[model samples]
Target: MTRMECRRSLSAPTGTENDTRISTHENESECNEIPQSKSYPVFKNIGTSQCLNASQEVSDTGQCCHPSLMGLANGHCSNVLEFFKDIPQDVRKCLVEFLSSGVTDDLEIHEGNFHHFFHVANHLNLRRLLQCCVEVYEKGDKTRIKEKIGMCECVHYLEQLVATAYRRETSVLWHEKDLDSDRKFQVLFLTKDKHARKQPVVVIDFARNFKIYKQDIEKADKVGVGFCACAFEQDGCPYIFVSGGEEKKKSQIWQYDVILDKWSKAGKMLHGRSRHLMVAVKDKIYLIGGQNVACIEEFDPISGKCVEIGSLPVAAWSSTYAVNNDTIYIFGGKNPAGCISTVQSFNCKTNRIARLGDLPCACSGSRAVVLGDFIFIATSEGHLIKFNPMDGSSELCALQPFIRRHFVMFVRNERIYITGGVRKSNDKGADENHLYKYTPETDTWSDVATLSTSLPVYTYCTVRYSGKCIIVPFEKFR
Candidate 1:
């Protein structure tokens, strides 16, 4: 019963200043008849001079006492916690008082009490305890703090560390509201102008939501070309089929149905479409650019046909596209003549395609995805371009890492997952079933889980269902 009570009493921190006297007497005693009830060894080690001073905190009956130290020279130390639950309250108080401000930072007074000490130090926001924590961590192995809460570099002194850390964590979560919904919105501060910047961003696609709708998401009514079977899916897939087929007839704009779990029909346009840029805004899908022609068309997958929205101010198909609110940005696409860095955009509501800006370098077939507010343009030839929509201006990301691939992909989950695609470079030529995952934290790409087959590079669309990213085989949309 006494042992159980002692354990319960020590569970809470106490500041006992007594218990030091009689400790030496017990240590030097040759008497084997001492009663077990009062023979605990915690107080039996103090020498005569210290034992006398220790008695000042003892009660009149010679029993241990707990009292705040007043005018003892140093300030009152934080309550040091005991790791063992069964310790007597008197002992816990004595230990805390002894190790208060006077204790050495590098030494552990009690063995096996590290966790209790650290927890209490963190909770009380004590500087001395924090210093002790840092010392213990430095003296011990890295595994000690490997999986700890608020994990990070340790401070040398505990003084206000615990209190400061709590406030920091609380504020960090305030800026992370949309993070839980798997949707993020960020504004880029590139020195460019003349673009709409309103749209919910779906980033880190592989780890979260599946599909794309931003920038130029327009709803088309009964729009298709030639023969139409009809394939329109919900939130439809965000993936775009921007690849230009060898023949003009091969390049096509298609949409995948995320809900129906199949790719459906989108209206074919009057002109033969190849190497076109497709972006969804509001309720309409804008198919921009084609080989030997700089024409743009809007397709209504529900209607199963296309309408000539307007022609781009430039002559190029297969141009790289980025969308910001109502604008479908076209940049760095090769014309029948050669590679051009011309920038253009199609406003869905305005019904027009206008030149916006130019690229830092003339390149095409690169991947452009939004991270935060700035659009990160990774060229097929391995150059990173940053374009600001507000004004038509772009710059090269010389310090950023670049991975080149031909397949069109999306930005989601803070990562840029690139599936299999052809690459042509002497130092980095890749043409296999390549699946790569990149972490923006380290700005590096590493190989992870791979797909059974290379992503279908249709001149059309693809959808991810359950855990499968299925691409509708696009022999013909109509």
Candidate 2:
């Protein structure tokens, strides 16, 4: 999809209140008397007889004259017509009681009020109302409310309610799995200065909020730009491996101890390859597709040895790959002829590569991640394609116009976040400074947050450790 089309689809509807307003004549016939129920404690305090008489008078005369309910009869109560239009009679009555009260101390009251409020808001397509609820919960004082609920508890409940409403409304588009178990993880970024040729590893801890710390690694001759890095476990310890970027340098590999904050040499690859992709499957780390290399190399961390296992059908470079079960799926890269759209799956058990299918378009320097049963690839053209390996089918689903060459894509919890790529425009815009989030369940793209520093296209390596995203820059800071 083009950028304009994507924006139109995501744009909010306008003039909803004017188009769906309920007439005062209809209100007179329908809501003549406020229902008498235990759920409506606010009405009891106002004196039911007096409240009903006032409601009837206002509904009939179209004038909110009652002093007691003047506030409700004017602003808040105006929403009742649209709110109750779709909601069931029982739910509407209960909601009216709770919302009319405006505040409550009972846990059940809080739950019931928010539950139906969300439903009503969704039914009316009141996105602003939902957003207001979130904003109020985040920024408003919880202590001032009658419920005495903690801010954290209120936010949690609000998220749950929204998720439930999203599922009910968009079941087909919604992802079945919940991300409640996903925790915040720290990110490690390796940045370089082009002029001085200085590379420093920066660690960002998001677990206890976001904090950044930088550490300098003992630089290697070959470890500069276009190098491949991935997080792997040796024995039970976690470590990061960096390998093969500079052609003049030998096939040297370096390992960094994440816990000790130290760097050391590891086993070298058989071939000096740059712009390759690395993923750890089970006990072995597999490096595939880079520059002129067609051969797939596997490194055993335990033995500190590297061996060539398989070769691609053609020489591929700058492609992205993700692992599922025992197979690694690689997609989109440039060959000698130019960019290719081939998808290849390498099965570890068989020790062979098989052609799965092709991408919708040829893409190089793209990124891929496995979520559930599908492998999602973010293309250089800013289109997101999901490939189902089971049936060998590929479909273009989402569009992100800012994704150009050299961007990094990673998944946290269940959402995919893309950072640091150039924009597809004549200006050669600085998209590297922004971070975008792709929600698979909704097939929408949104700008979430900005990065501390802009990343050069295809000059950085990213890995997720302990639920955090770590970035290592290979290009000079612009």
Candidate 3:
């Protein structure tokens, strides 16, 4: 799967209102009833309706605007708020009821009603209206609304609002596995930048697309989470491999169908092989070396078929492989007999394999990520090696704070965050608690923020999400 790019389709919200008004036909539907126009600003027949605009003062210029947008038009203040400007007494009560007295709603700096309202409020320096922007956006999921927001003085509005715990650079926070014990799921992820005015952090329900459902996190009777292979199918969403574990295990390859909210079992591998590593390249998932000297196999997700792809130089299992450009490069992994520092590369274009330089240490489970033209390999002995595939030349950088083997290193906002792995002194145990960020520009590692969410990295701990690295913490699953 290539990648799902975030397309900024939001149009700047305009202050102008639709001049093309529909005359009062007085039609009623669940959507809205007694739709009001300037001809009659107030309607007693309409039970309760929230007024989106507060422009009490009508400009005879016959120019209708989102009242907030008018602030940018003439920068003049008058008794413009007409009689109908207040969110209608009944509607006002409901809107107030929706808000937390202490929690002021903030808007996505550039989009939506509140985002624009906040902009006008800020231009006039009205602190109270500016605060309401937050809650309004949170009450509405931003990603879903990003495409509809009109671009209006969004930058100026963002400058004044308070910042929160949310990542300014992220447009979306993907919920990987939303399945309850009932075996349900929702999948997909995306992000955005800070200064850009965006929507509030509101939860969404994939079960009903376009309709939000409140799903309480359910407690499972018994969790059977274990080592599994992951690959992209259908579109770019990820699917898990429930087979390819130990032999004697009933053959099954369960894939989580995110959009449909279901699971599918693909055909089994030739035989079960535990502690095996999986990597997807050129639309096909390669079940690389594994325990029991398992043969490399190519899985066609479309057909649910597994075809053998020869074998690795060593009978290795659980090694890290990084996909760079058109090639999938395998780093160190423990061969069936022992841990090896061997390096191998498979070219997608040529469909052939070749060997590269040996890692400084014979470590398995560490991650190899391709950034720019360099592949950075970190090991269980706290060793960080930068290798170039073009000439097979490698340079060692300052090591990690602690040693880990099966951690996930992925890119976000152009920064690489390394999460979770195991160590040798700990045997098959891993304490992937420490998260590190490496800035290739500075060739430096800095500890940014750590996930308070506990993710255990046990013997079979592996993190993978289509188009991103697998992030986890240390754990002992016994």
Tell me, by lDDT, which candidate is best: 2
lDDT (CA) per prediction: 0.42, 0.54, 0.44
lDDT (10s digit) by residue, model 1, range 248-348 = 34434445332111233443566665556666665666666666656776776557567886888888755666668777777877876788888887788
Candidate 3 stretches greater than 4 Å from native = 1-226, 236-238, 247-251, 421-434, 458-478
lDDT of 3: 0.44
TM-score of each: 0.43, 0.55, 0.50
Q: Considering TM-score, which of the candidate structures 1 and 3 is the better prediction for this target?
A: 3
RMSD of each predicted structure: 25.7, 22.1, 18.4
lDDT of 2 by residue, 347-451 (tens): 977888888778888987777888888989988888899999898899998788564665667675477877765566666554565667777889988765555
Clashing pairs in 2: 185-467, 185-468, 187-469, 188-470, 188-471, 189-471, 190-471, 190-472, 190-473, 406-458
lDDT of 1 at 103: 42
Candidate topping TM-score: 2
Compared to the true structure, candidate 1 yields what TM-score? 0.43
